[model samples]
Target: MKNSPTAGYHTKSAVLFVVFNRPETTKRVFEAIRIAQPKRLYIVADGPRRDYPGDVEQCKQTRQILSLIDWDCEVKTLLREENAGCKNGVSSAINWFFEQEEEGIILEDDCLPANSFFKFCDTLLEKYRYDTRIRHITGCNLQFGKKWGDASYYFSNRTHVWGWASWRRVWNDYDVNLTKYDGTEVKAQLKNIYNDDFVADAWTNIFNELKAGKINSWAYPLDFCNFFNNGLVIIPNENLVTNIGFKAGATHTVDEESSYANIPLIEIGEITDPVFFVPQKQADLSIINRDFNIEQRRVKHNAWHRKLKRWIKSKLK
Candidate 1:
């Protein structure tokens, strides 16, 4: 795959633009969308939260940027009157998107995507539109510097939603509350898929928060949907979307202590198909350890190592 000109490149799939109260970031993301020039654009904006002082004006300005559709495109919008927060707000917006579209690319106000990313997603969306096993098409590779397999993309069971796409068939199965996973089935499935010792505790906390309305994320439940249905996600070999909204006002990115901010987007030219269509188990495990369970695994390993060292020293004494 070599880098080429994207001058007149336009996406065949419609795009769903999710926005909120960041005009600057929205403007930049809107510029990226402008380049892709999608045929149909769906804009979803959550209203300003009452507690955030300047949210009203900021939300207004962000919506203004989102509406500057100068290119030849059909635009639809769902602008809320009151803030629904990220959990309900984003889920509801996506629900609105799939209600009209069979499949489409989804971009947040802060996800700066490379021009090539649109093509990548559009190609996969059409290719796997009917494949129930292939559930997600994402534009992120959080392996840090590690590349997986010998193809342009690899299959995994994780949900990397920095920039992604999905079909109405799969989105219809997306459960925000994951009410189906309320029993021992989640524990069994989590362990089987993730192969993590502490996946139970880690996901238990997340499910608890989701049930109690303690967190403001929709991505978590989407991950549950991916796992629950045994769906494989197609992740690019090179990163195509760079998340640029990890600043002070960000809902989750700022609070995540994440190392995934502002990654340089790589151009994925001449997309190649993988020889094997199976999910790379090692890649999936790597994502869990490096991203989800890093802190917990580190603490456990350190305590075990310390206890082992103490036992050896006492025996010698």
Candidate 2:
């Protein structure tokens, strides 16, 4: 539980890297990956959209950036010829990656992970490889307290979309059809997915978008699908990865709103005890409470409170 080095640090497995048209961020992410030195790497680059004026050039640049991986690993590329956007691009790429491998570590374009993050994933993958209840291994945690172990990895009801890992068997149950919720069993499951009244409206909007075909492609539903079946997500106590695509040109992250930027840096450590899945009830409760509080706090507090928090962090820094 102390800050000891992770066991089997030398053993590396396949890592699926998903990228869009951001060449600079992609370069930085690859640098982090190179240091981790995975044995097999799967690169998925989204193609350019025909309507976008500069998409062709940007897509070419993204591909060229991916070509710069200097590691001696078995590398495979899933470069799309047409733009699939975030929904389709991420979904198809992840589906394709899981189809080939039993398990893999998944990273996005802007998630620059610490070297230790790779170790955490590799260890967890080996630790929970046989546990069917544990559905995901997440690399981001907003609350970076030492209340838990050195890793502080725990099961949560909600899935974090930052950097994460999962097995193919877990992903096989993902259903994109939003209409299935009309059934009796699915409505009961929907209560668990939304967790509470405050966040249910937002989820309803997302589901509506999916139903209306407004979103050409998406993956959050798949994440929700795992949660609906009572899947567990492993989250790091320390904030090992930083997302860097809040600026313009980011497809989905255009909102200027910021929340709790203080992420603690934790050193990855070995697990003396074998990893086990957290009980289903506890996992679901943690997810429900955590998700509800986070959304409620952000919405209830005004801009002045956010600025005050920012100022406090600045002073502390």
Candidate 3:
């Protein structure tokens, strides 16, 4: 893997782009991929829902944007004639991709990756291809400013799928039907892993909702599969992908002011071996706190205190 100083860094790995009716974000992400100029590019798109009034037109526009790829590359498309919803659409598209390719980078419409993201994923895809223990390599680094160690990346129990890469060996273990795991047994297993009843109960409740047909998501089930198999994800030292899909018309992201929205992207330098290949307990705990709303509450409380102080100062003036 020699870097060409003139042409810049390019990846030999296949790239999979998952898109639907969001042309605005798709254009931005596609531009980054064009710079990488992957040898093989796979486009997976879901049809517009017949019930939504303007969905069909938007979906068409999004697909039309894909025609901008003017480079000499092998392009394959999997366009659904009918809508498959988010859960089935994304999971099936990924399953189809791994069937033909051993491993590749995956990006959604809103997950805009940095130029280095492709190279980061390509390097790890080959490094851990045979190591079943490391199942996923994610471009998201949610630790804020904290670095787990001197390594360029660290292993995490949490799977961040905003922009990620993985092998067929791990994807083969994906099980959409989570009802097979008994409720009592599943709770016990998660409790052992987290060593906290509250954290385990929170995740168990979400899984129960998914099994009970209350929630529509593809990522959570993949997370469940990873944890159940004792698998780990490679998380970079700095965030490489920014999610810009928290606007209206989105399926799940309706928050106009989400904290995770528009995270800054950082270039990952040369990959270095970590001092240890283990999950950082403190960092994982930070994720759990953020997930359980504890961190959000703390942020709100601090904001309120600042507002109160400003009000008192104005009265004194």
Q: Against the true structure, whose lDDT is highest?
A: 3
Error of 2 at 298 (Å): 13
Ranking by TM-score: 1, 3, 2
| Positional deviation of residue 27's Cα in model 2 after best superposition, in angstroms | 0.6
| Candidate-wise lDDT, in order | 0.85, 0.70, 0.86
- Per-model tally of clashing residue pairs: 0, 4, 0
- Arrange candidates by lDDT, highest first: which order? 3, 1, 2
Angstrom error at residue 87, model 1: 0.5
Per residue, candidate 1 scores C-alpha lDDT tens digits across 1-317 of: 42322365689999999999999989988888888888899999999898887999998898896546777778898999899989899899999999999999999998999999999998888888788889999898888778887789999988889999999999999888877767556676678777665765677667778877787789999988888888899999899999989876678788444688888888977988998878887877776676666567769888999999999999999
What are the root-mean-square deviations of the candidates from the true structure over C-alphas? Answer: 4.5, 10.1, 7.6
Per-residue lDDT of model 2, residues 105-209, tens digit only? 889988877778888888888888998878888787665353334435656656676778889888788766554554335434556655554455555555666
**Model 1 lDDT at residue 86:** 90
Q: Candidate 1: what lDDT?
A: 0.85
**Regions of model 2 farther than 4 Å from truth:** 1-11, 144-151, 178-180, 183-187, 192-195, 200-205, 215-217, 260-265, 271-317
Per-model TM-score, in order, reads 0.90, 0.78, 0.89
